[model samples]
Target: MRTLIVTEFISLDGVIDSPGGGSHPRAGWTFKDVPFVEEAYEIKGREQLEAGAMLIGRVSYDEFAPVWPSMDDFAEYNEMPKYVVSSTLSNPEWHNTHVLRSLDDVAKLKQGDGAPILVHGSATLAQGLAAAGLVDRYHLLVFPILLGDGKRLFGSGDPHTRLDLVECEAYSNGVIKQVFDVVR
Candidate 1:
């Protein structure tokens, strides 16, 4: 079975909302805002690029479509085959993208012979996957700052999840990269 990985850049307080300063309520709470990147900070992103397919939530797709396709920094993100999990959106404007109508479809797609499926910026989707026991590994890049109020990775009334830490590292610029395997 292909591993499903959820990768996120979160604040110390577990806020994953608007790390890129979009129109969202909590905006610009990222290392990009302060403009700092240690050499060690670059590895996880490159590693995620190795995944064969990317599964993203609709909101993340909308936020990323304009900049990622046009930019050169995230070449892997632009080039990778992307499967978007969305209910309302009929058609995707981005190239090399497919829309998944339901969460059940994720399991069917995972049965294929392919590299790991990586998920990014899909808070709601991630929660659903966690509930469904679909996610295999979780890679969290914890930033230095903390936002008291914002979209959290674990919302209210979420079930307690048990995760076994695979590995963890601290970057010079205070970014922490933690890898965990969801325990059954």
Candidate 2:
């Protein structure tokens, strides 16, 4: 079986929205005068290269498709078998991209044995995956700041999903990387 890993950069208050310079009031919180951890790149680069595929939500696809394809540093993301989950996205122009129309499409993709399937910065998709019990692991990079008001990882109405922490590492910049296995 393939593993589905949801990776996110979240604030201490569980806010994962617009961490990458989005127009929110607390946007760009991930890189706003914080201590830089050099090792983070190495860790993330490893994961990016190790992942077999990229499964992103519509919102994230909109934000990323234009930028990621043009970047040279993100070669793994640029060349991977990209799956965008969106009912509205009828056409995807990015390289090696495929449009997934439903949750059933997502489930079908995970049926075969392969390297890990990675999902990044897709809160709605993450919630849906959690609700459907499709998330195998969560790799959360928690920043120390608290963005009091923004889109969060878990909404009040979302289903309760328990996770077991399998690994955790704290950086000098007050950023913590936590790896959790979704408990069945």
CA lDDT of every candidate: 0.82, 0.87
User: What is the per-residue lDDT of model 1 for residues 1-184, given as tens digits with 9 covering 90 to 100?
Assistant: 7889888888888888888766656687775544477654565567556788889889889888888898777777778788999888877888789999888999988888888899888789988888777888988888888688877787776678899999889877788889899888
Residue 166 in candidate 2, Cα distance off native in Å: 1.2
lDDT minimum window of 10 residues, candidate 2: 33-42
Residue lDDT tens for model 2, 1-184? 8999998988998999898776688778788746778875455787887999999999898899889888888898898899999998877999999999998899999998899999988888988888788899988888999888887777787777788999899888999999999888
Model 1 error, position 93 (Å)? 2.0
Pull out the clashing pairs in model 1. Answer: none
Provide the TM-score for each candidate, comma-separated.
0.91, 0.95
Local error of candidate 2 at residue 21 (angstroms): 1.8
Instruction: Give all candidate RMSDs, comma-separated.
Output: 1.7, 1.2
